[model samples]
Target: MTDETWSQLLAGLTNVTWQSLVMIAVGCLLIFLAVSREYEPLLLLPIGAGAILANLPLSPLVGEHGLLSVLYDIGVGNELFPLLIFIGIGALTDFGPLLENPKMVLLGAAGQFGIFLTLILALLLGFSREEAASIGIIGAIDGPTSIYVSGILAPHLLGPITVAAYSYMALVPIIMPPVMRLLTTKQERAIRMPYSQRQISQRTRILFPIVVTIGVGILVPFATPLIGCLMLGNLMRESRVVERLTHAASNELANIVTLFLGLAIGSTMGGEAFLRPATLAILALGLLAFVLDTAAGVLFGKLMNVVSGGKFNPLIGAAGISAFPMAARVVQKEAAREDYSNFVLMHAMGANAAGQVASVVAGGVLLALMAG
Candidate 1:
């Protein structure tokens, strides 16, 4: 090869700009958060790596025929990865906690209060109706739901929305604690919720996914795809005969989809896409969205506590934010901080699980409101 050929081969290195370096540093910080802080490592690590790879000048990981580009076209662009991931989430999820105490579903619906609240805020900040609606969904705290909603309503903002959604989700353990403590007193936090030893029949468990899929589909057709995939995975797990499928969906399929989803999202974090005033607004609104969700859940929990004559611990309400086991675990930890034997984890799980379902419904409602 001539000297000109050597220069052409090294163009990526030669053309590296200061902006790219800044983006690379940001990616490194994400990696550090994954490795040292152990914050959503599975997502942050891959996403961080993808950001670094994509930010390189003339990145081979983007554009037509690029590996990340192909992955995006295959899944993220078509909005398949999030749905696939939901299947895995359903396969791994335990709905028994939710089924035992159906009342927890109320907290789940209450938790979605922030999404609409934030939608107005985003609109006030100059985002269009569709953009504001997409931005508001960051409160869902479920990564797939955020991706699914944003990809539909405002695809241009998907990058920042996805980042804000996932990052705030990882921060749930932190964001929830102060709010939970502030909202409930020591006496309230010490309130104990008796675990329902009620057993859910195998038949009921098997019927749940089918019933949910049908009911939710009929009610909000926009939600059918999201709810359908999720229930399908759950059905596979509940069937008992499909143990192999369940295991694969929960493990192999989930892991692979997570990686691809992470890379696709990170690829969107190109220097031009991410380092903008709009990106900053998204991150800010996302934090507010999560905070508001937790607060709404806790306030409503407090109201229920009053109605139940102190039978309810307001901390359980914080678990209603669709953060899954993490939010539930946080509620349990807060309770344990007050009383070691204050075992409300199961109850919290019920609410937390309800939030999981309610969040998707809320997303569907948003879609119907905006697109329909």
Candidate 2:
């Protein structure tokens, strides 16, 4: 064989490291969970593929001019992809439920308690304030928000934070129930909240996004970018005149950006960056944040129940995290398990919708606090 051919043959093999192999395995595990367990398949599958490609010896898909790097520069680096995703999320979200039960906003605010709690814990464990804040956002269960915040505060930690945020988000149904049951009694679970079908006028619906954009921008200026894009999509959704735009934002735009974002994120999971003591701490802390968020919401719900003379179902508080309809559905399912006749779906939906907004604000607040 020619000298050149022999060199080429040995190049990839010689470059291989145990770190790369472990990362490849981690990537495959993510892929397995995504395909077999159907855990956040949209993001995880692409992330796994990206990780594999990036770790390949002398991969052309990495480095300064590579596609992954370009995607990272264009989207993740500038925090554009996550903001774009938020637009789609806002377009798809239904605020009518929250509008019907304005009081549910309290539960949404309560849901964010874990982010701060986890931030303090992370700080105590020797993480810098910025790093801890980035880690704390995992509690919001809003992957886009986590990405946006972490990308700014501790960009190096993005891979683990994003993974933790989405992974726990996927596990919301599994993780929340135990905490809910442990915090509340069977009677609280069985409490029925009759759905109030309040007539939310078209004007009110149209004004919500606009008012929120202005209000949040003024109050939490750092959050304006995230909230603006989110509310822009929501405004398009509620405008009715922009059905085409809304549909595109919620479907095509979201899907395309999601693909790019996932790949960019996965590319960052190179073994040298991902395998660390801090990474494990991030995962553990992220889980704690999620649990604490759920616990705080449920405890607050219990308080509301007492204030309402036992009329409020504390399970709805468990829906106050940013898992959207899924968290709300889980609450309903749990309530039904206690008593087949109890119905709290609508009420839970209200809290869930409120949580969606609350998470965005929480991300912004973190940014504001961390901003130099």
Worst 10 residues of 2 by lDDT: 187-196
Model 1 spans with C-alpha error above 4 angstroms? 1-10
Q: Candidate 1, clashing residue pairs?
A: none
Tens digits of lDDT, candidate 1, 56-166 = 899888998999889888999889999999999999999999899999999999999999999999999999999999999998888999999999888888888987888
* True lDDT of residue 280, candidate 1: 95
Model 2 alpha-carbon miss at residue 273, Å: 0.7
TM-score of each: 0.97, 0.98
| Residue 140, candidate 2: alpha-carbon lDDT | 86
What are the C-alpha RMSDs, in order, of all predicted structures?
A: 1.4, 0.9
TM-score of 2: 0.98
Count of clashes in candidate 2: 0
Clashes of 1: 0
